[model samples]
Target: MSREAAEYALRARADERDRISGDLLDLESHTTYQVLKGASLRGSTEQRWTATQESLTTLWQLNDAYRAVLRRAEQIRASRARPGAEQLAALTELLAGSSVILRAAAKPVERRSLIPQTDLRLTLDEAVTRMNAAFREVTSALNDIDAVWNRVLPRLDGADADLSKIHDLESELGETAGLTAEESELARLRTAAVEDPLGATVEPHLDRLTRLLASSRAELDLAITVKREFAARRENLVAALDLVRAAESEARLAHGAVVVKIALPPQAQPRSRVGALAGELDALDVSADPWVLRAKRLARLEDDARKAAEQARTTAKALYGLIGRRDELRGRLGACEAMAARKGLAEDPAVSESFARAHALLWNAPCDLTKAAAAVENYQRAIHGGK
Candidate 1:
């Protein structure tokens, strides 16, 4: 190379070396790299991190050698106001020749022989290439481990906090019956996350534990409320039972009226569980039973009582509907008779007979609604001038 070309090359390489040195400082001081360096990793993270450390060591050694070459070139240039041919030649060799020596003495036991080991040497450009590859390897490993810790560790902390809340609720309620499995699961997840986060599956387990904790809190709250307010709740349930009894009595009276006034009425709905529910409520040994058990029992009893009252009210409405139909037929029959009188068919034998049968069927006790409906139609036809 010519003198002028060597001078330009030396200046470019020196600048590149400075940039690489700044990048190395940034990598060493990175937060994730620091965390991985101090962490005791296992599994995939351990294997990858071990390889990355080897690459990082080699990268630093390469940088040192690169700096040495630039330093030699700078010294040669600074030696004279205008370097001669020999100085330029030496500068070209340092900037562009095989000037960086890479130590390769470490070898496997099987690869060792009696021959002396030789160091591998490369030019400044080749040294930078090798260092770039090593830097990439180290950065990729740090990022991978950082991603796993970022994704799993925060979730583990959140799960631990939830478990603490559940324990507090259990203490407040003075119960310790159902959380053993959850506690064991939480411990296992935390251990795996800390020791082998690279391979741990934490989200699904955390979600399930969250749901279980919510259910446990709800149950604990229910038990506490039942313990504190059982008296007021029992009173409300008793009043519901009284309403059921009232509906049952009203249904029975309507059924009797329908039986006397209408023919072929449907049978009355059977008495519901009001008596059984009242007995169950009275038999509840609140002082003896656990609040959880009492809560379940009270819930069942209240539901049953509410259903019984609704059924009785429905039955009463249906029975009264049958009596209302009979009254409706009577009114229609009377209106047909008045229309017959207006048309001068009141004296007609066939019209009078039809009106009589319809009136008797409608006004008489145990009224046959089907026959009364047919008779009313006949009377109406007669009033419309049908023979």
Candidate 2:
């Protein structure tokens, strides 16, 4: 190659350098381009950021290579003009080089190799290629940034909405009168969530918020069931109270109707214990404070009321049994006397004595049921062979 080709090649490199330098300067100056310079990125973002940084560094070096090769060309041209043995040796060395190696880190090495050649056409091509590659990589990084932003933006934006929904759920529980006295930290976190919705620390709580809402819903459902059951129990107590009164009234009526069958007034009546149970039931204040249905107190009260009703019914049965037995004894004693007359036992002294004793026991005041039963059996055996 002649001096003219070397100078022309140098001029061409210089022109291309200006164009690439201007483009790079514009890229560096742009606000959006510079935004992520010092900021740290995480996960896959970090890898992309590192790749982009490396590409930009390489492009900058390639752009600065134009100056380096031009300086070296000038030196080779100067040494070729003089044609000394040593100068020609240096010129030959420059002509032997085919590439312009641009190393940004080694300033001393670059200074020593200032005498570059016109043989760097390959270097120019490679630099342009690296610049295009770097530009494409930067565009890719920008796209990835947009994608990552899209991914997390909804979670960030909906943070407040989710928290508000949780509040609404809790309020619903409050409406049902089932809210527990225990407090949760969810309310306190709401303020922080509103302040920094995208904060890493608060972001994970979105899941917790969802779980809390679900848990509260379950608790509220259970509470509602308990509340309904308690209401049913209260109604049962009232019904039981009515049942008990009816049973008590039935006992008193039975006692009055069969007064002649049994001997006395008080002894034949249903026990006072059954009547006192009604008072105990009436004393239970269903309207009392802190009804505490969650603890099943209402169910306990209902059981007590039911038991009281059973007591009244049992007392009625006992009184009815006693009166019915007295009537049965009178009928049996009359039958025994008729049988004694028919069998010629009426004149028998033993038979007559048994019949008189049984008569006294069955017909008297506060009739001794145990003695009357034995006497009637004795009188029957003496009269008609225990018929």
Candidate 3:
């Protein structure tokens, strides 16, 4: 071999040794130390012994190969004077060392089944899977952060203006003055709703989003807990989703029941004719006849029922109006959630900041949605309420 060839072979072997050593270190950190310690303990499985022995053997072989390569490279460096012969000798030694190390490294690849069959295997496997999921979630969260900084922050140049307008409205409506506890609370709630349509709008779809975020965080925490507690058991995403769906279904059923009650007509009973007759018979008035007076009371009751029915109709109309307003509020809340999702700000820094601002506005000592709405409406009413 030429000097150039000898140098190339030496460099290749050195590179390969470094790469393999790094991989070995990583594997050692992950598994080898634990296995060796487990093997030394009483009542340890035979599989642990086998795996440890195999790993140690591989480690020795690779170390020997690395040392041999270093020795050959040193010899080559020293024999530069005797060109061709020295080069050939050094090249041969380098090739032999490289071949040994490659073969030793190949052993692990060939004996893939050397992984221990033990109770701890399942646990370790589950830990690995959970680690992978956590890595992915972290990556996704990072991406979301990037998106918020890149896309959402730029759009918030008008936030200060909006805030100023909100303040002005508050001041104009005397919301900033000393007020009743309830009034202050309403003002706070309204400011929050206006500032962070995403976080504070809990009436419609935004409420669902808020709930979803909470649910997701809870699930992530639960998944981590389960992974640690039941390491041997695999957690399925489908199962988690099923649990959420079940809870949502139950909630919807309950809500629907409430809605049904709201929609149902109130029950009213007519006076009992038999009871009236009995009372009249007990009186037993032969001259004036108590029955005649009973008939007049029955006529009066019929008139009262008719009047009540009319009032009920009016009550139903008023309830329908309130329902419409409630639906509108729900729709607005939904729009806010959808907007946040579209902007990818539901869990990002910008959204979090917005939520904080909203909380400050709404949750200050007392919370009041009505006063805040009035404050906001006063300004809008002055500018565009007529329109």
**Cα RMSD to the true fold for all candidates:** 6.0, 18.5, 32.3
Predict model 2's lDDT versus the native.
Answer: 0.62
Sort by lDDT, top down from the best: 1, 2, 3
Give the Cα lDDT of each candidate. Answer: 0.82, 0.62, 0.42
For 110-181, candidate 1 gives per-residue lDDT tens digits of 989888788879999899999999999998877776787788778777777777876776787677637888
- Please give the ranking of all candidate structures by TM-score, highest first, separated by commas: 1, 2, 3
Candidate number with the higher lDDT (1 or 2)? 1
Candidate 3 runs further than 4 Å off? 30-53, 96-387
TM-score (C-alpha, index-matched) for candidate 1? 0.69
lDDT of 2 by residue, 1-387 (tens): 444555566567668767777777777775545656755545455666777888878766766664565567567666555445564444344433435576534445646566543333435566578777887787667655645445544654554454454456446545533323212444444434333233324446656655555565555555455555655655666777678678777777767765655655466566434455455445444444332334244455556667766776776787678767988998999987987888888989989999999999988866778888999999988886655
- Which window of ten consecutive residues has the lowest lDDT sum in model 3? 119-128
Q: Which prediction has more favorable lDDT, 2 or 3?
A: 2
lDDT of 1 at 238: 85
Q: After superposition, how far is residue 186 of candidate 2 from its true place, in Å?
A: 25
lDDT of 3 by residue, 24-101 (tens): 566456432343344332222233334445545544544554556567565766667655775676566556423333
